[model samples]
Target: MNTIFLLNKTKDPTLSEWYERKINDELRALGIKDVHCKAVSSEPMALEITHPLVLICSSSILRDTYSYQSAEQVYAPHAKILAIIVHEKVKFFRHRFTNLQFSPLRFIYNPHRMPLRELIFHLLSQLDIDLEVRR
Candidate 1:
């Protein structure tokens, strides 16, 4: 099964929990039984995950906590990395992450602006997962 590792380092714990619930709920609604979604706060735990993975974390997590060099050491090329950048910081984050060697690093600006379904679709698409392939 495909696994989505959400590396939440957001300021609001409630918002983080809500995001996790939304992703899992949406996956079920989409009949995507083969994919599993989980939220992780530890960087070591996040790095240890090697399944068909999708990472969701905030810009602050990337910028202030983890560096691209450190991430490149642990992150596989096939893994789809998504950064949730605050609305005002999108430009800075875009400029920073865009130049990385990673091919498909997606950025979600102001996540609260979009519906949960839209977020789920975008994330699942990045993994190139076939929802029909059930376990």
Candidate 2:
């Protein structure tokens, strides 16, 4: 089974719920029956290293003392980690430490500047899901 872990450390309940629902709906629509999409508000005890993980890169997560350590725990050889920029002012992941810490994750999606549909498409594609027969 494929798994998607959305790590959202921010306090915005409304945005978090919307992101989880929309992503889950899109994955299901793409025929991912055995997939698990979860929105986690804090660092998890353990994460499946092989699964794809989406990190909600916001000001809060960046400034958190444990964010770096938490991100390290999520890193794995086969894991596909994506950072989504939610802050309007953060046009890019240019923070000195952020660039170094999250540099391994090449896929960065900025919903504030780009299309949400595009992010979904990229996410599904990264998971190696076939979108030809979308339901």
The lDDT leader among the candidates is 2
List TM-score per model, in order. Answer: 0.58, 0.60
Segments of candidate 1 deviating more than 4 angstroms = 52-105, 131-135
Which lDDT tens digits does candidate 2 get at residues 1-135?
A: 777777664556566567788878876676667665777554543254446767665554445463445354444334457545453455345544333234334445555556566667666677777647443
- Candidate 1: Cα lDDT at 57: 42
lDDT of each: 0.54, 0.57
By summed lDDT, the worst window of 10 consecutive residues in model 2 runs over 97-106
Question: Which candidate should be chosen as best, given TM-score against the real structure?
Answer: 2
lDDT of 2: 0.57
Give the CA lDDT, 0 to 100, for residue 131 in model 1: 55
Q: For residue 21, what is the lDDT in candidate 2?
A: 87
lDDT of 1 by residue, 1-135 (tens): 777776654555555456567778878877888776777666676666665344444445445434434443434333436544242234455444332322234445355444556556666666777555232
